[model samples]
Target: MKIKTTEQYNRIIQGATAILLTEGLAAFSTTKVAKHIQMAQSNIYVYFKNKDDLLVSVFRYHQKKYIQFLVDRIDLSLPPTDALRNLVSTLDEFHRTNKESLDVIWSIRQSTTLRQLIPKVSDDQIFIAIFQWLKDWQHQGTVRQLPLMYLTNLVFSAIIDYFQLIDSKEMSPNELAIEEIVPPLSALLFV
Candidate 1:
């Protein structure tokens, strides 16, 4: 019941993520996650309060990792267009390289039923950093004055949606390259 190490905890999350990606959230359970990782179900219980906690944690974990990746790549001090390009490029790169993890989360967002089931968790500053940067740019009239949520979602969802199409084989892998994506995305976000 005592969660031992960070590595083990992350392994459990990654195992649950695999289940979510392959079997869908409707099929996810701590027992399946345990079996997927070849561990006792109680070990998952030790780390999480219950199924929802574990589920929320899985989403939160992946989001935090991705936000950190994006934030690290774009300098807040840069001109808005330059920063937006960096943001777009980083996101496209993430989609190309981190398909497996992105598949789990992007699918979750696509499902209204799954969205309502997962409990909301408070986010750390890392989660707020990207939004804050966008907000700062908006205040300076560099970014669009539209609702921040919509603005952010448009940029991220566009890239992920395309990648999801490719992952589902609904679209060809070569349908769109990063070069074609970034310029339009940067234009859409910055003035």
Candidate 2:
């Protein structure tokens, strides 16, 4: 097993995700993952040190994929309200599409070992784009002139809680959509 470029490294991560999605994380053994990618388990060792490394890589890969999915689907040219709607809706759609992956991600506790394995994506980078959109609405007097970072945290906090509730089975997706998601977000951003 020889080390190679970033793309091959990513493919191993992707292979782990495919196994997790189909077989559930409990069954996502390194041998099974190697078979999924048509490689030897020894080959994976060349890239990821062990099972935890592979799991963390998979989580990071999925996070990037989720963000890119939203980036691709969202319309930046739209007005603030419309653009915000598109972004939120894209998140909702992502949760629906990758529910299992999200479940696995949430299951990973923020312990030192797991935290060390996971890569960091800055919250500021994600929110800066949102703030730029909100800036246009603020100028038009459609939104309040609040601190962009604060507002960004507020919105994502709500979204994360919603996902947690859904993941816990405390709220069904329909309840989340009608009772929690659409109404409250509308009030926060539009009203």
Q: What overall lDDT goes with each candidate model?
A: 0.73, 0.71
lDDT of 1 at 135: 91
| Index of the highest-lDDT prediction | 1
lDDT of 2 by residue, 50-147 (tens): 89878887777666676677777878578665666677777778888987656556554344567656654334235567777766777787766777
Estimate candidate 2's alpha-carbon lDDT, on a 0 to 1 scale: 0.71
Instruction: Please count the clashing residue pairs in each candidate, in the order shown.
Output: 0, 0
- Candidate 1: C-alpha lDDT: 0.73
Worst 10 residues of 1 by lDDT: 118-127
lDDT of 1 by residue, 1-191 (tens): 36388988889998989898889877788889999999899888878889878877887777677667776676656777676666667767787777665666666655676577543322434335557888998898878789887776677667667766777788785777655776787778888
Per-candidate TM equals 0.75, 0.67
Candidate 2 error regions (>4 Å): 1-41, 50-52, 104-113, 116-126, 139-141, 176-180
Error of 1 at 128 (Å): 4.7
Top candidate on TM-score is 1
The residue pairs found clashing in candidate 2 are none
